[model samples]
Target chain A: MKTYLKLAAPMALAAALAPVPAAAAWRLVDQGETRKVARSTLVVTAPEEWNRATERPSSRSEVWTQDGIALSELTFYAKIKDGETLFKRRQGKRNPLPEFDKDMLPTDLVEWYEDTANIVLGGSLFEIVEVTPATLAGYPGVHLRYSYTGGDNVARLGEARVAIIDEKLYLISFEAPRLHYFDRYIAGVRAMMDNARFK
Target chain B: MKRLLASAALIGLFAQPLLAQETGDETPEEKPLPSAHGYEPQDDLEKGLWYEMDEAEKSLKESRFLIEEPALNAYVRSVLCQTVGDERCAATRLYLLRTPQFNASMAPNGVVLVYSGLLLRMRDEAQLAAVLGHEFTHFEKQHSLRIFRQIRTKTDLLSWRSVVPVRLPYPAGMATQLAVLGSVYDFNRDMEREADAGSIEELVRAGYDPRAASAIWSQLGAEMDATAEERGHRSDKNRNGGLFATHPRSTDRMGRLAYLAREAAGDGAGELYRGAEEYRAAIGPWWAQLIEDQIALKDFGGTEYLLATLAGDDPLGWTGDLLYARGELYRARAEDGDFAQAADFYRQAIATGEFPAESWRGLGLSLMRAGQKPEGQAALRSYLELRPEAPDAALLASMAGEAAS
Candidate 1:
């Protein structure tokens, strides 16, 4: 009986460490299944099983995480209207997020992300390491790669792919700690991006 | 009553020469400052306060935010020593931090934290000396202990939580720490006035320009006004936000400092020095990084004012960076036709041939916004050619392709 309890103890701890899905907020995303992302105008097919976070679904965005937001996060933005900002609205601020403009260039998109990281997110150190052009949803888009030292003093790396289609903005981004988490999930993110489609 | 009146008259007699000095019409003979040495807290409460501050100092020493550049550190220490005299300076330990806020605070234990933003704004050694002297006076006068005692008396529940640990995790924790520091240990108006008067006296005695005190305050006022104007709000007469926000408006502070400067300098202003060139040379290597930090705040009006102020001093040396910064400022503002203005600045920056590769990308975007598609596409192609491995290269190529068609 003692040996059985010892074996069960390790199993219990393992269960605790594993990602626990909030019954109402999350649904299992099976491998090779194409599913519509909440609030976004696009759909994605996961190459593997993943958890979709739906705790706070809005008309503009959605979040998916393998571990948790702290480890890694994949955020999607649908057809964000011209003059609208990404993410939830905040109050009592002079400058909110830069409003999306129909005429925004890839450079403008990069600047917007920079401002979001430095000004909105209040990073201690934010640097754009590279900027290149990419295709998203069969449309020309910008790919921005940046790093920031977050308030916690942990270094983080982020990549964003953004495009303007039919005067609306579509964005997909991944952020994770630069240690092991960023590289660990980057391949999966790229695969997911490869399978992403807009109806 | 007769004795009090006589003393008041005597004070007025002493003040007259100082007032005359403000107009550069007369000079008062320099009086030797009292030797500052062997300062120790006499009371139990004061000793306890010092002990608490010593712990904070220990934690601050280990903070990653502390700027550890030996040259910059030594330069600041030398200035503090000059201002306070070497004997008293021995008791103070200065730490420079890279935080982008215009503040310098002295702990009761003689640990002074000077923020990078303050260093960026100071145009000369005299200005920095005035600020350092003011903080030094706060330490010498035991203002923090008095404030701590008052708060302790008012709230029994004030806990150790107020002293935020330096290693606390990211953004939320940092915000809480900053908020706590902002609200805690703020000295009363009387203490601030005393520090101002005492610092000016120290500045003059240290051979720095007395007028630099008022000049710093005036610049702060102008920055505040510009910020207000840019936000489309009427400048508030009472809006005091930066270093003096807790003390008084810049106008009031400037008025008092100007009066005191005259009193302190009298006719000896010519002997004093601003040390502008020497100061610039000392801080030269760090200036560009400091300016970038300020711009990262996205406070367009304040940054614009700062660039203009620095440009006025050395336009030829500052032109390339200034033009690029102006383009960035206009791009962020994003008002109608602001893109065209931004494009023009980028063009000027590119003409200098010393601008960052990002300038080419900025020019391309601005041109596109201005409806010059072909020119914009050509510039974008140039950006791609220069930065072949840029993260956004694919997108730029696609745009260029569309433009050609």
Candidate 2:
């Protein structure tokens, strides 16, 4: 368990800025149970119990948080087609977010994610620390480790696994504040990514 | 936390205003305050304000947003020292933040922040000194404390006005309320004007080209115009009412500064220093990173305008770095026909043989997107050879072919 009360004020301010739903929109996902996610053809078994956020970043993404989102959150993107973005476009935004391309190589995907992170984080503080060949659901993919400071000015570490199959993209990403939460939950996040499967 | 951050941002937005009441006559020169030696809080109110700034400054030192490059830090601090004397410069702490916005700020406790975007936008040392001098003047004049007191007093007055109603006609009542609100902004506007006039005197005294002060505003105004034209809307300066705005429009400031510069330069003045070459040399090593951050802003039109303007300054053709920047801009935008544009720019940059090795990679990707397969594959092979240990080398190698063809 993580400490939530210590940073309640800033966390509450962050929640206010986010597209949070009513209290009931948060659901519990029991450990060791497989479930479909994000209204897409992806399934995964939880390595631990989590509070699932229905107000996800995008239509094809689902968010699961162990503590508050200000601490740690895992997200899954499933079946993102070409020309679709990772998050919904903000109305009247002058600079459009980068869109997925079917012909994107593993490296292109990593660059695309970095661009998105820079836009979302609202600065140039995002840095990609490492990139390596990996597999998602036993298929070739790329894994990326990165870090960025959020709007709250807190440094967070993130890892993502991305793979494109049949002109659709699948991504699993986990992020948490770099202080203590990232190290604590990174292993479980990796385990969940290893076990993820296409339904 | 929220209020403190908001106030800091508000302070950062401080700039001179152009009031309509000004006759074209030159405003009187502003005398600089005495050297800040052993400055400290004189009262409890100031002490409280300093305490808040101290906390902010502590976090600022550790912020990931800071550009901690030693050379860059020293170069900027040297410029600040030139703007103010070394004595006053010692009393201020300068931080270069990697934010893609044209802004700078000085806090009550003498924490000065110059955003990276400001460095990228400035064409020469004179222009940079103009801004740095302005910010330092704010510190010397204690604008932050005065502004704080003004805001507190106004807030108290506003509260009393809300409860103790005075009868007035409909439009009269609304105008009266607006007048009260306008007074707060007007006070800030006056502070900005003083800082502006003060900086020009200092810029001239330091032997910099005073005209460079106004050139910064002209370039910024042009970029704002380009952005508006691209977005199909009225420019922000057009939409934001000058009365409600804390600072004057960029065009207004540009004209005002030009007038002040002319007056300060006087007749038969010797050629003053712009320091363009020195500025370029100081910023050369960080060019790629600075350009990357600017492009990441995704302000397509503004970036395009800025790149073209920079290219215009080159005596010959576009520099290899500028060409690469143009290619990156189009590639990142990825609109229809952008891939072809990107490929052309990348090709031009590669021909110079002074571009980053990544130019080959950019060329390959752009060509691939434009459906030029064999050439694209060849370019990709070249990139893999040049950067065999790149993080994406294996994937590019697999895409291009088994080996160099």
- The DockQ of each candidate is 0.18, 0.27
The top-ranked prediction according to DockQ is 2
Candidate 2 local lDDT, B60-114, one digit each (tens): 6666667899999999999988878788888888888776766666776778778
Which residues of candidate 1, in runs, are more than 4 Å off? A1-24, A92-95, B1-66, B155-184, B233-241, B313-318, B348-361, B377-405
DockQ of 1: 0.18
Once fitted onto the true fold, the runs of candidate 2 whose alpha carbons sit more than 4 angstroms away are A1-31, A47-51, A54-58, A103-105, A133-141, B1-35, B155-189, B238-246, B250-252, B266-270, B313-317, B402-405
Candidate 2 at residue B292, lDDT? 93
TM-score of each: 0.79, 0.83
In terms of TM-score, how similar is model 2 to the real structure? Answer: 0.83
Residue B72 CA error for candidate 2 (Å)? 1.1
Candidate 1, residues A31-134: lDDT per residue as tens digits?
89888775665788888787777564355667777887767777777888888766544431444456778878777888776765554444336678887777
